[model samples]
Every structure is written in structure tokens, then in C-alpha cells.
Target: MAKPLVKRAIRGATVNTGSRRFNLPEREADGDWLDAQGEIDGAPAPLRTSVTVETPRTIITRNSSPDVFFDRSINPYRGCEHGCIYCFARPTHAYHDLSPGLDFESRLFAKPQAAELLRAELRKPGYVVAPIALGTNTDPYQPIERDWRITRAIIEVLAETRHPLTITTKSDRVTRDIDLLSAMAAEGLAGVAMSITSLDPTIAATIEPRAPHPERRLRAVRMLADAGIPVYVSIAPVIPSITDHELEHLVERAAEAGAKSCFFIPVRLPHEVAPLFRAWLDAHFPDRAGKVMAIIQSLRGGRDNDPDFFTRMQGAGPWAELMRTRFRIACRKHGLGNRGAPLRTDLFRPPAGPQGELF
Candidate 1:
């Protein structure tokens, strides 16, 4: 009989602890212990269990960054388990003593007090009314949201106050709040952008492991549209040499699905995301790695990434020009709106409160 394969948990080495470490191991082929060691014997490393934590903090982060479209945003959770290698938000995990690679997708933090904090912030005297952006940092509708319901609670507060809000997500789970969203849309208080990276299921599975399937996202777009909500199709971070070819096709499909507007952005590899993306490419598509990066650099002014304002979102150079031209042509061909039409902000009405309340 063949021996069973042993599985072990991998952990980071402690500071100044030599090259030796300890880990528990078990068989892979069968649920049995093969060996136990307190010290390293030049064997493989072990894997660790995923840890989830709950955090209490104020919601509604204010941002003055000129690049962002919104002045304020809300994120119900930290650390996305969707595990997209190209996620620019991955670096945030380092602040929590976690790896931006595997740990980013496993370790998660949920804000249970988000609704209360939002209510308090809204009730403040000086709070200004603007369209609050949701899922700006981490997706508010991630799988854990099913139980936390933090996103829903925040939405409830916003709805009660008639605050204008916008949501961007890659999950079909957002459909659960369609009734509220549709009502808000009727009052010009809400809009949604469904991010569809690729129509190919295989590529989607590899790039966004835990996100809803592409077909499902398309269905979500249709549902939102049918509910009288403004729906936009976002083909974000269009990976060059990879999913770039699918731009026009994706736009056509989204248009058919009732999306009124379409947008696309060249890929970005900011911070630690660069290394993580490179690792993922090497693991999944080694043969096309160099070609893929080469195309990205072409768009990014001969660099791995371009962080310049105005240029970052749309890139420069010939490759950038080609992508822009293609997108424009696609939008025209499909009758999609030129760019996302700006949501109404002038119509916002602050929640009713005391006469002396701060504005």
C-alpha cells in the first residue's frame, strides 16, 4: 500500500529564532498522523487555520484625496476573502500583522458596530449630505455579510434618512437589498455599479476565487435594472494581454443585460499587490506572464504601474490610447453612455433633527 501524504500548517518564523521551527503535521491521503516533531528536520512547512476577528470602530471615513470622486465612504469589513491577486486593497492587511498574500484572504475583521456609528455620524450637527460610497475599500457584500448584516444595517439608516448613496460590488448578494435600492433610485438617492472583470468563468474562478460567477453578476445587473435602479457595468483593472481582449464583448453582453453605462480601467499593481499578482501569474499562467506584464508596462508609461493622477485611472502611451479607443468604439457601438453619468448630489436632504443641529 502507498503511504499517505502528510499535510502541515505554514507559519512565519519568529525573530532571531535560527532557521529551525515547529509545526504539527497529518496525512493528506488519510486522516491519520504520520509524524510529530518539535523541531525542524528539513521537512516542509505546515498550514495554519484561518482566523476571524470582530472589531469595533466608527464608520464613515472622510477622504479629501483629490483622486477619489466621493468625499466620504463606508466599509463594513476589513480583509476580503475573495482573494483577487490584483486587489490594490491587499496592502491594508500589513497594518494588522498579516501577510498580503494568503493571509489577506483568510484573516478577516467585521465591524459589528457599523450601523450605530453611522447613525451617530449622521445625527452630528456638522455632518454634510453627500452620496456615500460603499465597498470603496473592502466589499460590503462579501460572504460573511450574510451573517453580519452590517452592510444592510448601514443601508437601512441611509434609507431612513434619504441619504444619497452609491454601491460598487462584484457580488450578486447585493440583490437582497433591491427593494430598498429601487425605492432610493425612484428618489434619485441611489445607484450601483456591478464590476464584471471577465465573462469567462475559468478566468473568473482563478482571479476572484470567492466572488460570484460572472454570469451571476450579469444577472444582478439585469435585476437591478429591472428594479428601476441605475446600473453601470464596470470592467475594472482590465488586465492587459489577458482579459483585455474581452472588453468589447463584455460591453455588448452588459448592454444586452440592461446596463445603461460602461467603464473600463487598465490594470494597476500598487504597493504589495505587485508581488502578489506576479506570484499568481507565475502559478497559473507562467507562459504568458512576461507577455502580460509587457503589455501592462506599455500602458503604464514603461513601468510596472503608473500612480499619477488623471493618468492612473486611464493610463498613457500607445497601449493606453488603444484601450481608450477600443472602449470608446465599443460604447458607441453598443449605445452605452459615454462615461458614468454623475449621480445627483444637489438634491440631497439631511435627516430631520433639532433646529440648532450642526450643518
Candidate 2:
């Protein structure tokens, strides 16, 4: 029999772990490596993040989901390093034959050609302009973006083409692009949604390990608002028995940070996320893990998740109703009702061809 992979904690990571398959002991039809590891190991070194370039021929992804706000989106990267255990997008990595656990965090992919491809797509003769949603799948501004600059490059392309854009991210690093964003906002071409799940540092750290601190996110919200850019605060994945309690307080904070509005989603455990979340709760909040999951199940129509369109975003059942009610009340009290003005698509123009720079 093989040993179960050890559960360990990595700083800035929810669960310093890998998926079942990735963690499997190296089977050599022999036990030499396992014995050798035991002899020399005190504790294994922490996993390091690696980035790979993904060259995709296209950049914009179109969708027809009635529930989502936008029809077109761009994901500059695959596999987020933020390692939020509750992330609904975790299962995406499985498509690449990568683990949805720690491997999803440490093994990352960047689309350096994103900006160029976006330009090409925009130049297509029949291209129709709509607000391009950024960071819809994996965060566009994940850590590796500092060196890769794919997100910024994509933004530059959007800004140059006069395309309307909506960005959602938790990293304060978005502030680094304020110059471009502010320029677009002035033209009614850009808006941003900053996701801040919890105000408590400890909770935030554990849930979104590599994400920017809550305070930093708040500051970024303020910065965007001050720049005359529309910014909304997202209290996403409101986990029962954990982050759910912070709801009203978070709404108040968002209002104080100058957010135009606020919205939240009850945690959704779609696909592989349910097991990962269950393991996370067991490891971090063992005492109430059962209670947490019970409430979640009740909200999820007696299952780990409710995939039904409208219900999936806000959840269902009494618990779900209560959460929505609380959110509405809080928003009303804090006067955060604005959803920001509609973005203008009229300003869009195709990228000025390959030598767009020579102008």
C-alpha cells in the first residue's frame, strides 16, 4: 500500500497540497526512492510556482450564458496562484491533466501573445464590440503577471482599440494599471470589480492565500473611485460558518471605500471544488466542518452544489434567501445601490493593424 500524501501548510496558500494523482508516490515497481526520501527528509521543501507560455491563436472567448453579465471574455492566464480553496474555477486545470489542488496554484500558464491575438480578433472585419470581461476565469493579474505583463498588454490593446472593458480581480496590483484604466473610464469604456471575500486578515489569508491583503484591496477600491473610475466591491463565495458572518460589515466597508455597489455569492462547490473545499474545512476548521457543509448542502438543494443557472450564483433554499435579504438590507443601509453606468461600445475601433505603434 502507498502512503497518503501528507497534509501541510504553505504560507500564502490555502492548502499546501496537490490533487490525489499528483501527490501519489513515485511508483518505480521498486521502493528505492521512497526509502531514500524517508532517510533524508526532515520536511519537504515548499513547492515553487512555475509559469509556462501558452500560445493560443485566439484571445476573446464568447459565451451565451443568460445569467452572466457579459458575452465576451478574455483569460490572460490559466491556473491561478491565489489558491483560494473555494474557487469554482479549480476544475478547469483537470482539462490540462493538472491537479486542481496545489498544482493548480503552483503550476501556472501565461498567454503572452494575448494582446496580439486580441488585436487580431478585434481587427476581424465582422467583429462586434461588447464589453470584454477580464479575469472572468482565472485572475488576469495573478503574481506572474509582473514579469509576463500579459494582462497589462491585453489592457493596452483594449485601451488602444477604444474597447469597453470590465475587470475583476482581488489583487491590489490592479492599481498599477490605473493610468490606463482611468483613461478608459474617462471615455466610459472601463469599470472594475474588486473581490474582497472577508475583512478579517486571518480569514482572508487562509481563504485566498496569495491574494492581496483585504486592506490593500480596499485601498485599491478607494484609489479607483478617486480616479473617477467606477468600482464595485465583490463579497464573493460567502462561506457558511466562516465568512458569512462578515457580510454586513463587508458591505459597510465597501461603501466606506467608495464602492459604487456591492454583491455577493454564496459559496458554490461545483465539480472538483466540493472535495477540495471539504478537505480545506476539515484541515482548517475541523470543529465546525460538518456544520459548515450541512448548511451549504441545505443552501445547495441538499447537495454539494446547485448548478441551476440563477440559483447557482446566489444559492437556493432558506439559507440562501436569508443571505440575499441580509445583503439587500446592508446595501440599502450603506447606500451602495449604483451598479455603475453602462459601458459605451461605440468608442471601439479595430486595432490599427500590425504597425499600430508606428502611428
Candidate 3:
């Protein structure tokens, strides 16, 4: 008989460290263990993140989800390192036979050829121009972007073609591309939305471990708006008992920082995310765990998630209605949610070449 796999938990990591659930033959760890150095430990070791590069045949992903604003989006990377406990994207890691827990954040994949693939797709005869969205699944400006520069390269291609584009991210690193985006915005071809969940640094750190601080995101909004780029604030996945209280404050502050528009979504715990969020609540807000879940279920139709179209983004029930009311009132007072110039797809020019240029 084969020996069962042993899994050890890593401290200070958002996801619980353990073997992936997808692994087969049903593995279990033995309680008995031996220390290599005979029981000499101060603090638990931290989990190390590893990245793999993939050369995908295609870059643009087509989505027909009515809830999403865009028809197509590009994800330059997979498995975000930001490690937000409530991230809806975590479950995607399961497709790789990796645990949606720690592995979702620690084990990452980058598409180094994203720019090349995008250019090719854009040059195709049947290609149509629309605002291509970045950071839909994984943040294009995550920490590793500094090294890979893949997202920047992709933007360069769009700039060359004068294509309309939208970027959503939690990192201020998007500021680095201001030179490119600002020029595109000049022609009504670019816009950006920065996601900020909480104004409290302590709470921000606990939830979104590696994302830019809320203040930094606000600063980026100011920088982008000052540069002529349309900047919007996304106060997304507002946890009922935790971050929801800051709804009015977040939108008002973002408007003060030059965010012309704002939108928010109630927290949704789909599949594996439910347990992960529950674990986080137990560790951080044990006192309110039951209450929080109870409120969330009320919004999700007595379930952890409501995946229906239109209704999924926002939920039902009085609590959801109350949150929406607060957001609307705040937006009205702050002069936000005023959708201005639309991104222009008419300016796009197909690249001329047999092989797509790598920008």
C-alpha cells in the first residue's frame, strides 16, 4: 500500500497550507512527526511563492456574462499573489489540480507571450475593436509585473494600434504605465478602475495581504485622473459585517481623489471560497462570524452565493437594499457615478505584418 501524503500548514499565509483537494487516492497525514533539528523553532516558516511562465496560443478571452461590463478581457497572469481572502478568482486555481488555498496565491503562472498573442489576434481579418479589459481574473500589475513587464508590453501593442482599453487593478503599479495610458486617454481610448475595499490600513492588510494600501490606490486614482485618464473606484466584495460599513466613506474619499465614477458588489463566497472566508472570519472576527454569514445568506437567497445573471453582482434582501441605498446617497452627495466619455473603438488600426510586433 502506498503511504499517505503529509501536509504542513504555513503561518502568516492567507490560504491554509495543505495538500490540494484535487489530489487523488485520498491522502491523509500521520499525527506523528520528527523534527530534523530536534524541536528548535521560534516562528513557523513562511510559504514561498513560485511562478511558471506559459506561452499561450491565444491572449484575449471572450466572456458573455451579462453581469460583467466587458465582452472580452485579457489576463496576463494567473493566481494572484495579492492573496485576498475574499477573492472570487481563487477557485480558478483548482483547474491546475492545485489547492485553492495557499497554492492559489503562492503558485502562479505568467503568460510571457501575451503581447505577441494579442497583436496576432488583433491583426486577424475578423477581429473587432472593443475596450479590452485587463486584470479581470488576475491583476496584471501584481508584484511580479515589475520583473515580467508582460502587462506593459501588452499595453504598448494597444497604444500602437490606438485601441480602446480598460484596466482594473488593486496595485498602484498601474501608475508606471501612465505615459502610455495617458496618451491613449487623450484620444478617448483608455480608462481605469482601482479596487479599494477598506480605508483602514489594518483591516486592508488583513484581507488583501499584498495589494497596495487603500491610500496608495486612492493616490493612483488621483494620478490617473490628473493625467486625463478616466478613473473609477471599485469598492468591491463589501463584506456585510466587516467592510460594508465603509461604503459611504470609501466612495466619498475616492470622489475627493478624482474618481468620477464608483460601483460596489456585496461579498460572494462561491465554492471553495466559502470555507476559506469562514476560516478567515474565525481567525480575525470570531465574534461576528455567525452574524456575518447569516447576513450574507440573507442576501444570497439563503445560500452562500447567488450566481444568477444581473442579480449576482448585487444581491437581494433588505440588507443588500440598504447597502445600495447608502452607496446611491453617497454617490449623489459626492458627485460620482457620472459616466463620461466612452472609450472610442473607431481609432483602432490593424497592425501591418506577418508576425505581430512585440511592444
Q: Please provide, for model 2 over 181-269, each residue's C-alpha lDDT reduced to its tens digit, 9 standing for 90 to 100.
A: 99999999999999999999999988888898999999999999999899999899899999999999999999999999998989998
92 Cα displacement, candidate 2 (Å) = 0.8
lDDT of 3 by residue, 144-171 (tens): 9999999999999999999999999999
* Global CA lDDT computed for model 1: 0.78
The C-alpha stretches of model 1 lying farther than 4 A from their native spots are 1-56, 339-341, 344-359
Give per-residue CA lDDT, model 1, range 136-252, as digits (tens).
888889888888888999999888888889999999999999989999888888899899999998888778877899999999999999999999988997998789999999999
Candidate 2 Cα misplacement greater than 4 A, ranges: 1-5, 11-40, 355-359
Off by over 4 Å in 3: 1-39, 355-359
| Candidate 1 local Cα displacement, residue 228, angstroms | 0.4
> Each model's TM-score?
0.84, 0.92, 0.91
Backbone clashes, candidate 2: 0
Error of 2 at 21 (Å): 13
